[model samples]
Target: MSQVPMITLNNGVQIPQVGFGTFKVDAAVTQQAVENALEAGYRHIDTAAVYGNEEGVGAALRAVNLPRDEVFVTTKLRNGEQGRDLVQRAFEESLGKLGLDRVDLYLIHWPAPALGTYTEAWAELESIHRQGGARAIGVSNFLPHHLETLVEGAEVTPAVNQIELHPSFQQPATQAASREHGLAVEAYAPIGQAKDLDLETVTGIAREHDVTPAQVILRWHLQQGTVVIPKSVTPERIVANIDLFGFELDEEQVAAITALDSEERMFPHPDEGNFTMLD
Candidate 1:
């Protein structure tokens, strides 16, 4: 089994640099997919309440029979559950669904700035962390400005900021801001969700490195000091995604991929205030 590298978060929690994500995975197959990932050597698993697969994830974890502490699990508070009281309740409900006492990490899934309660939600997450409901607390889909608002009033800095990042959308400004505040950046869609893997630059680099474009892209993320969660239901891809530690990218190759950044985001902008997921 390949050993995944770990990155220490600002709060001193250690997370695997490469993780398996269960974003769009169907609940029916989520268990088997996660099991395949674990059997393939992935110890970190990222899921969200809105993803509708927490139960499946729980089932897989139980089936694997590994010591609970040996694996890291992360889940999020849905956009609809954005206030202090609601977040607390939502977290308990998520725990119930996952059948776990606590998650390794719990995240406020999005800023939902229109709701005007993300900061309050952050406070609740802090309370949960204090009470040991979550080992670590953080936010997702949060822009630097949103993080600034959070930091101004927050008593504890977020351990991480999960964002939609890829070679095509490097988010240098956001990445820099996260580093400035000592928050670890976790990249969702680390392989561009297949959006730019076929680009000439990525493919050319892959050819030079004798790796698939996906491997090249994931390696780029790892080299940039970001945690990446690449999701796949296919067994081969799940196994292949974690097979990233064997190679390293040269500075020019890394720069060529970095230059592919145009700041084009594939997901909704957090500032746009779309909480349509609540609907």
Candidate 2:
């Protein structure tokens, strides 16, 4: 296994800087895909109830048979399931499917401001963490205002806030709030959903380093101190994503990549009718 870098959470847990995200992976194909990522030496696995693949991911875990502490597993509370009661039930369902008594990290998949219950749901997650059901609890896709409310009402500070953070969607304001609150930042779609794969700047950097564009981008996220989850079902890409610790990006190169932030969010907000809440 490569010496993958680790990011220290607020509670001081060291999580692998790069994780394998099993988002949108077909349930039928997820088991093999996750198994391939594990074989590639990925120590972190990110899944969610909305992804509908916790069972498949759990199967991969059993197949790998790696010691529990050696791998970090994370899951999230889905949008429709955001509430005191529903959130508690949703978490139990995820835990049951993942076949784990406690998750390394658990999160509110989205704030669901429109539904008007994330604050209460956050309190529920705080309870989950207190009960030792999850080592760390956090939120996803939350804006600064959302986080402020969470901080004001939450008994426990969220250890992380996972969001869309590709080069084009840097989310500087959100990142600032997370930092101010002592929350670790986790970047989903860190490679920009393949949008940055062929960009001249990214490709040029890859060529200069004799690495793939994907590797270059993942390296940029790591250097920026963001926990990145790059999802790939292919075995070769799984190995390629984590093979980034061998090189370093200097200040100028890092700045050039940082300049690519355009705040473009590939996934539309749930409030914009992209999703509907269920009772």
Candidate 3:
């Protein structure tokens, strides 16, 4: 097993810098996919209620028999499920589905400002944290303004901000805002969904390191102190995604990849619609 590096969040919870993502993974295969990832030395598994695979993730955990603390599990509230009346119930449903008493991290999947209940959702998350139901609470797909609004009434600071960050679409402003509030930045599409693998800069760096472009890109994120969850159902790819610690990217190579940022966000703007990151 590769010695994956850990990022200590503001609340003192440590998460693997490299994690196996289950965003688009099918429920029918989600169990086996998570099983294969666990066998491949992945200690972190990211799934959401919207992903509809928390049961499969739990099944895989039962099958693997690894200690609960060995794996870091994260889930999110559905886009339409954010409010004082609904948020707590939704979180309990996620926990019941995952077969766990608590989750390592729970996030409000979206701000859905139009719904105007994210601050209320944060209150419930804070309550969950106080009750020891969620080790950490955070938000996803939140912009700077959303963060500002959330913190105004939040008694607890979010530990993380999961966003659609990738090599091709680095939202530097959002990252700056998240850091300003002491939240750890997490990247969902860290590889740009493989659209960045064929880039000249990425390929050159991959060739220099004798690794795949995916590994190089993930390593770049790691070197920059960002948590990345690259998803794959294929066993080989799952294994390859976490095998990143063996090699490292130097400053020049990391810079070349960072220069590829074009603000070309592949996902919808956070404020535009109630996107659940379903794609």
Candidate 4:
């Protein structure tokens, strides 16, 4: 088993640098997938209310029989539940599904600024953090401009900003802003969803490292000090993804991968045309 590294948040809490993400994972198969990830040594699990698999994830944690404190579970506040008053209900519902008294981290799934609700949501997150319902709080898919507005209106600085980051779309501006604000940067699609494997640069690195393209990509994220969550349902791939700490990418290799950034995003904007999942 590979040893995963840990990063310290702005509030001085430690979180795993690499985690297992359950984004599109079906609820019916989520329990077994999570169990496999746990067995493969993933201490962190990233989920969301929108994913509709918290109950499955919770079942895995329970089935693993690991001490509750041994694993770090994170769930997000979905768009529909984005106000101060509604957030309390949302958090409780997530907790109930996870069967945990408190989640390790809770995130504002997205900043639906057009609706003008994230400001209220941030306050509710701060309240949740203070009340110990969530050990840490963060935002997802937030750009620098969005973060700035959030900071201006937020009472607590978000501890982490989860975004679509990979070799092809590095988001340097977001990374710089996160570093400047003491918010940890988390890469949601560090392997480019395996879409960039055929890229010459990525293939070249994988050959040099004697590893798979996905491992090379993940190593790049780790070298940049960005937390990465790469999802895979296959057990062999899950094991292979976690086997990254054994090797190190040199400066030249890191730069080679970093140079591939085109600032493009693979996922569609959750904030386009004032449309939202809630609607």
Model 3 clash tally? 0
lDDT of 3 by residue, 114-197 (tens): 777788888989999999998999999999999999988889999999999988999999999999999999999899888999
How many clashing residue pairs appear in each of the predictions shown?
0, 0, 0, 0
Worst 10 residues of 2 by lDDT: 270-279
Best first by lDDT, ranked: 3, 1, 2, 4
Per-model TM against the reference: 0.97, 0.97, 0.97, 0.96
Selected candidate, larger lDDT, 2 vs 4: 2
| Decoy 2 TM-score against native | 0.97
lDDT of 2 by residue, 1-279 (tens): 558888889988888998999999999999999999999999999999989999999999999999999899999988788867787889999999998989999998887777788888888998899999998999888889989888997789999999989888899999999999999999999999999888888898898999999999999998888999999988889999989878888888888888988856798763553244552
Across 148-242, the per-residue lDDT of candidate 1 in tens digits comes to 99999999899999999998887888888988999999999998889888999999988887888999999999888899999999999998888
RMSD of each: 1.1, 1.4, 1.6, 1.4
Position 103, candidate 4: lDDT: 94
- The lDDT, on a scale of 0 to 1, for candidate 4 is 0.88
Which candidate ranks first by TM-score, i.e. highest?
A: 1
Specify the poorest-scoring 10-residue window by lDDT in model 1.
270-279
Off by over 4 Å in 2: 270-274
Number of the top-ranking candidate, with lDDT as the measure: 3
